[model samples]
Target: MQDTTMAGLWALGLGTVKAQSTVTKTMNASIPTLVVLANLPQLALSVIYVLVNRLLSAMAAAREWASFAHSRKGLRVTVPQGQQRSTLWLQLPYSFAIPQLVLSALLHYFVSQSLFLAQIAIFNARDETEDGGASVSSIGFSAIAIFCSLLTTGAVLVAVVLAGLVVRSEAEDGT
Candidate 1:
């Protein structure tokens, strides 16, 4: 759920930028600034991925602790031995980790596709034009980018729903 919220917040920020660009049509910014702006989504998504991964690890630990507390086997160690030692990444089953990794990749790809800075030269129609033309630059959004972003969000939502179902099933089965 936290991961979903993070994705939603990112989507909201993208939508806000799109709306602003649509209304203004142009934004004055330096090349360096545009470059930084273009990469911001990637940075934000990376942070989100780390936070979500940690959240999943914590959830797995809690689930394991609950099971151990209730088990009739008592204080037997749950941690795996040898090279398959317990760690943050090892806490989650591959079933959960793989989808999360795929979704994170998709999120990064879709976000990179969705927004970018574009510079276009504009010519003046007036005869009294001094410089004859000027360049306008702004962030641009594409329909396909919007579609990709929404698809990624939907995929994340579906993953969350599936995880919930798995947890519920495990509880019912006492496993």
Candidate 2:
């Protein structure tokens, strides 16, 4: 329980950090359109939600492992040769979740950048069809990138929900 609590606190701290960073960036940014700023709050909320929930999942796993190691269900993870054999079903939330979230965040950021660029490109393309910029190509690429971003974020959200389930089970078992 101590371990889980500590881990949860750390998770909360990291989640706060992610939220603060998003707010900081949004404040410093100079987006001209309300549409761009409109997206920031939702994205930042997502990062905070995922980070906190996933971290709690990881903490639950850790606490369960630690308790299993200490108590006797007649299960010793390590062998007589002093080989540690635990962590069979453990999933490090940060290992998978954080990177996925970061990647998704980056892609969203770029998605907006691409849209802005594409808008400018459209203006230019109308005036000059043969503009040397990779304008049209970028539009296609960014569309694909945004699709992939949604896919990744959706997957992560599902994983986090499952992780939360595991954590809840651990809590019930702990009692």
Candidate 3:
């Protein structure tokens, strides 16, 4: 199952690279470098997420077991009183991270586009052109940056969505 998840991640990476490659005929090899730079932080976040989630899940399981044990011993089980306690270890910045992921994506896109446009302006600064219709200044999208940013934003979004689902499942199971 872990292998499957890793494989899916790799596929997602490849797909994003391939999708962005459609924009220009620049160096295709640059994709990997940008991807690595952009994803390093997210990789750390992913590891933290998995570790903390496992810890919380174990605690929840232990609490459930203890309650069951007490009930089997003919003692009444006290409902796990703290609603916030259930999520203590695994609380994500849902209010912030969700919108942050989305906004970061859009911002990254614009930044990348601006860089590409700047590059175009630089190339055209000498008034050089292939078809003579216009200079390279018209290019408006930095393909690599956009791709990398999207990759990162995508990872965060997936994590957030999965976190929401797990929280919901845990709640439902407890009830």
Best by lDDT: 1
User: How do these models rank on lDDT, best leading?
Assistant: 1, 2, 3
Residue runs of model 1 more than 4 Å from their true location after superposition: 1-25, 69-90, 121-136
TM-score of 3: 0.30
**TM-score, one value per model:** 0.62, 0.37, 0.30
Model 2 over residues 1-175: C-alpha lDDT tens digits? 2233544434433212222123332343344543455456457756765675557556656656655754544433534234444443335435545655575566555445323311223335367644465222111123333444566667656765676676666666763
On residues 24-140, what C-alpha lDDT tens digit does candidate 3 reach at each position? 444343544544544454465556546645554554555445555334423222344533233332233344345544655554453444233212212255666545553221222
Question: CA lDDT of each candidate?
Answer: 0.66, 0.47, 0.45
What is the per-residue lDDT of model 1 for residues 81-165, given as tens digits with 9 covering 90 to 100?
6544344455587777988988988888778867777665655556443466566667765445567778887888787777767
Query: Alpha-carbon error at 5 in model 3, in Å?
Result: 25
Query: How many clashes (backbone N, Cα, C below 3 Å) per candidate?
Result: 0, 0, 1
Each candidate: RMSD to true structure? 9.1, 15.4, 13.9
User: lDDT at 43 for candidate 1?
Assistant: 92
What lDDT would candidate 3 get against the real structure?
Answer: 0.45
Instruction: Give the residue spans of candidate 2 off by over 4 A.
Output: 1-31, 34-110, 117-141, 173-175
